[model samples]
Target: MSINFHEVKKKREEFWNSSLVYKAIHDRLVKQGYHLIGTIGAVKRCHWTKEAVVRKRFCYKCLWYGIESHRCIQMTPVAAWCWNRCLHCWRIQPEDVGMHWDDTRPPVIDDPEVLVEESIRVHREIMAGYKGNPSADQLMVEEALKPKHAAISLTGEPLLYPRLSELIEEYHKRGLTTFLVTHGTRPDVLKSLVKEPSQLYISIESWDKESYEYFNRPLVPRAWELFQETLELIPSFKSPTVFRFTIVKGYNDNEKALESFSRFVEKAQPTYIEVKAYMFLGGSRGRLEHSNMPSHDDIRNVGRILSEKTGYKLLSESIPSRIVLLSRIDKPIRHGKGCPDGVEHPEKYAPAFSKEYEELTD
Candidate 1:
């Protein structure tokens, strides 16, 4: 029997459009100043976006990781969808309850070109509110209006968006840098990308299947295997790739998982290894206690373990975000205004980005 994709989409839209639970989700997001994309996509101002607007502090990605958050537009192409309901996620929504799309995927999707245009336009509209404020930094506003960076990670799994490659191309054509983060559930989507982002991040919240279930609460089966597929493909990408570990205390943070974690990190040999602490915030608060939040020193200790196991040398850190950066010895951090051309650009020049970080010697 053949599947009716059209019917599948229609049913999904009906569920989202007519449900009050989802209505509440949309209402809350809109009130938070999130601009809707198509019927389901979304773009929102990052708290760092506000800081950059008012010229206070930039996001940790900028201060430590090199991307200028002040000139960044944080968004999600498939904002209302995700595969896992991780306990640490800040965006707690009714739409995220499922592991896959309604039946399969959204019935209606905004064109990649149009969504790109709308994303920038919507972001601009949100920024309009800060224009007349007395405290707003006009210089920052001017630079921000002409966004040079895009963090496609505000909420949801960006890979779920069809034409995601085209979306990246559109941003690149307009001279905007792209940073895409995925939960690693869609390795097939990752493999098919025609145009890679300036920076690609695959989040690894767990090292084993048991830890994955306990910490991630994936809505679908074989979630761990799916994540592994993405992990194995990371080394082959044309652009700079990263494996991000969002560690929650007493979940996947113990030494028991460290050896498995080391084995996985060897696959991508990412340019940077981010050992980030999970914060107790938003919907996560309802599911986990504040005690679950890890301290900076805790993350540091874990970073050291990863460093010791993988040979990546510890680099810089942002204490506020409670994250540490580990660099592959020979890779020498390469960053620039736009794409880090081979070195500055994150294209798939395998020779340069070659292998896991292994500089430390004990």
Candidate 2:
């Protein structure tokens, strides 16, 4: 007799939805601005998106890579599943509420196409609030309704979602660019992707395995080995790869840490590196001190040191976001298809990139 996988998945979904823990957790998440999409997917409005719509201030991603902030849908497939409980992460933790669930995955999965469709619907509903506000830009607000990009890194481990490649493909089919960020623990999933995102990011805040365990607080064993495996696999990707470091003051910014990070950077040789300061917000405020959030100058200092060691050029900096972008090439890779009006005149919007880094760095 053949076992029915769909039946098993349906039963699992029923069990998850009927549990008291799920009800409690779901209620809290709903109140916290996370709109659940399908069975396990979620979409939340980014603060930067609001800034872009109301104040004409874009995020570091927009300033660096031409991603329109207001027109980006920030969604995640596995909203409640993550292998690591990084103290710096702003998302609420299950342990905080005296609850625990499987960190590796959800009880059941949703179809990639359904999740994508529902995500856009929910994103538009969330963005609708701006239309009534007098301060919101009507033109940008209208553009936001038709999202051009999907940021699949909101609050969970995206690689854990089994059908992530299909999800990326679905978004691409709808003429949207996808940006996937992972913790670099799932090499098998990364290697098996039938369709890759427009850009991929591996977040690294720790230098060594010991620091990885301490900082990331990974739930699984041999996480360091898994991370190393993913790093080695980065060079094989066709899409642009990025190493994002969320630098917390007095922790991963020391000289010894930079040296260890340099060794890994040499091995991966990613196209770009983002040195970003950790923001003290949400649940992270409970775990770390206020001083742990580094200033813009501190980010640049660490970024310069890492650039020198890794031979990557310091390309640009976004002071408002407290982040810096470093790249192997001189110019940024711009995507005009997803951008509004099929053009992203970066120089017109981002005046900071006007001067050459040779003069700025010197």
Candidate 3:
């Protein structure tokens, strides 16, 4: 019998882990406690993960709305994959986003079950380091050990993962609240999801197609069409939906872009809108200069413009993270399912305080 060495070699090279370039990245990620899932995904510890345990402070989300930061896991089902090589992105885009993963011919696509199992294990392992820290709070540590929330956005385009719904279900089954962030590139995938995330976020890079293409550098031919489709479906979803904007100064920060953004916001009619500054970090540092990183004041000024254009009340601001929250006056704080600490449910409004941390960073 003749062995097919070609197939074996192909399988081995699929991981890209052996390549010197990828190896360096993998090593650094592992050092920071990132757990690789199958061939193209990863789960990493959130800064809030450690802060929640140490009693320092929760993520702006916890401070804004109310989720136990320690009880949340940060993961991405597709880490080494994305359709847009966004200039402001902080994570490494494994490939120059082309038509789609199928068209891109990714090396590996792991089972959802394995991804979940390994994700939990790696998250726990990362937290294990905090056990010995003097500032660790025993109560919060135990809570952290038993996570109740999952943010499926460590990096990459999660919806690109074929089995993301299953992954979301897995987390939901485990009693964990889930959030799914998409770049509004694949409304077809979003439409098919039966188990929508507890909160759904569509990251809007720019309002105008020209700026959108410039900022996102998408691989697909009609990327703007996909975004428009996503906006159309926003109000139809029973689940709370949000539009997140990562404002990069001198690029998507001009008055024209903001005006266009307001038009898109009106069309989306999302439950909430988060305006955030684009930080200069990760592979983005190569594409954009530090001058591109907008200041908190810069972000606030744009937020003020958006509030005027959309009539979405300015809910709150996080000076440190360079972000602002806006909500429809009717649903601002009194109806997020519960306030100060609550998970939003579909059509089911809770409590009278609504402020969700709009995490736009990787």
Candidate 4:
């Protein structure tokens, strides 16, 4: 079905204002200034916790959060509309929840400078009441209020935004690092990005083109070709690249599929590989059975199989969410100079080419 970006945008606005989940999340993000958006149910199910929130506790299990103890500030840039309605996605839907392109994206302010100013202003207003909340940790609260990094992945394909490259450069000039997560549907947009992000992530949900189409429900006609092309070009860029595979039980979790996935990773040679289990949420309930969410052991087994095939070591695992990290043993850690943890600052980290772009643009 061809998506009308304008209608998608309108529906998203209506949904964002009316949906309890969206309001709950928006309220928290506005108050805290930043928050991680991912599968809360997966986190809870893995951790065996009654709490439904996906927060620092769950983040502590993640490779990036585990490695960087002092780092603060994380948020997916936009809250609505994604280009692909992946069957594995946990977000609830009638399949067009927010998938619009027209004027649906937040309007491009007349002045970039004004947009920055308004962003800061809105951020402060959202955080106003939290100033005196007794339960709030002052240090973490302060960090959350600051705009250190913007992750361009929340619910949608950020590259679809016509002004994405411009927005990335603007963030870079503000000394904020940008993290872009793409579904690998648009290589042209990826290629055109002016500022290299601290990290560029491509999600490869399935190894085979047919399985990819079956799983991702991408809007583009030739998504598989685009995914392959993007993987091939990842090595040429200096910024850290991550290949994310959200493992679904009956779909691509078997040995043959995993082996094919490993070969793709070997060819791409990204700095990191994340293997995560699919969580049952949102619109996925209609299309997938609850049994599709794999167990922690299942996730670990898959990781082991892929690791052996790719010669990548299993570096970390978020036991609660059944997620694992794999990396080449020989991959060198290029610690950014400003990062105190010896790991790149979550916000300052960018692809190696970002500096060149920054210099050229200046």
Best by the TM-score measure: 2
Q: Which candidate is the best by lDDT?
A: 2
1-362: candidate 2 lDDT, tens digit per residue: 24344664465457447987887667767777787776777898887788778767677677767788888999999877888999898666777557876667667677788778878887888778899799999898999999989999998899989999999999999999999999988999999999999999999898888898898999899888999999999999989899998899999999989898888889998989999889877568778997898887899999999999999998877765677888887766865322332123433343343322111121
lDDT of 4 by residue, 1-362 (tens): 24343553455455446656555544433342232222110000112111111122323212352222112233333444455668876433344333323322333222333333334434444444355666544554454455454455645566656566676677678776666788877788778776677778888778788887788776656778888888888887778888888888988888778888888888889888889878775457778887888876888898899888888877666554456778774433432222232122322322122211121121
Candidate 4 — what's its lDDT? 0.56
Which of candidates 3 and 4 is the stronger one according to lDDT? 3
The TM-score measured for candidate 3 stands at 0.83
For all predicted structures, in order, the TM-scores are: 0.83, 0.89, 0.83, 0.69
lDDT of 1 by residue, 1-362 (tens): 24343554465457567766666666666765677765667787776677556645555566444565667788887766677878788774554443223422454565676667767877777777787788888776776677777788887778878789988998999988888999989888998999999889888878789878987878778989999888889888877777788888887787778788888888667777889887776567778887777877889999999999999888756555577777785444434442223233222211112222111110
Clashing pairs in 2: none
* Model 1 stretches with alpha carbons more than 4 Å out: 1-17, 95-104, 329-335, 338-362
Which portions of model 2 miss their true places by more than 4 Å?
1-17, 337-362
Off by over 4 Å in 3: 1-28, 31-33, 94-105, 329-362
| Ranking of predictions according to lDDT | 2, 1, 3, 4
Question: Could you give candidate 3's per-residue lDDT for residues 1-362 as a string of tens digits?
Answer: 23343543354345555566556556655664567755566887776576456645555566545556777778987765677878888666554222123322344666676667667766777777777688898766765677777788877788788888888988888777887899978898899998888888889877677877888888788888888998898988877788888888888888888888898888878888899888776678778987887887888898999999999988777665677888884544322121253223311212212232223242
Q: Count the backbone clashes (under 3 Å) in each candidate.
A: 8, 0, 9, 13
- Judged by whole-model lDDT over C-alpha atoms, candidate 1 comes out at 0.71
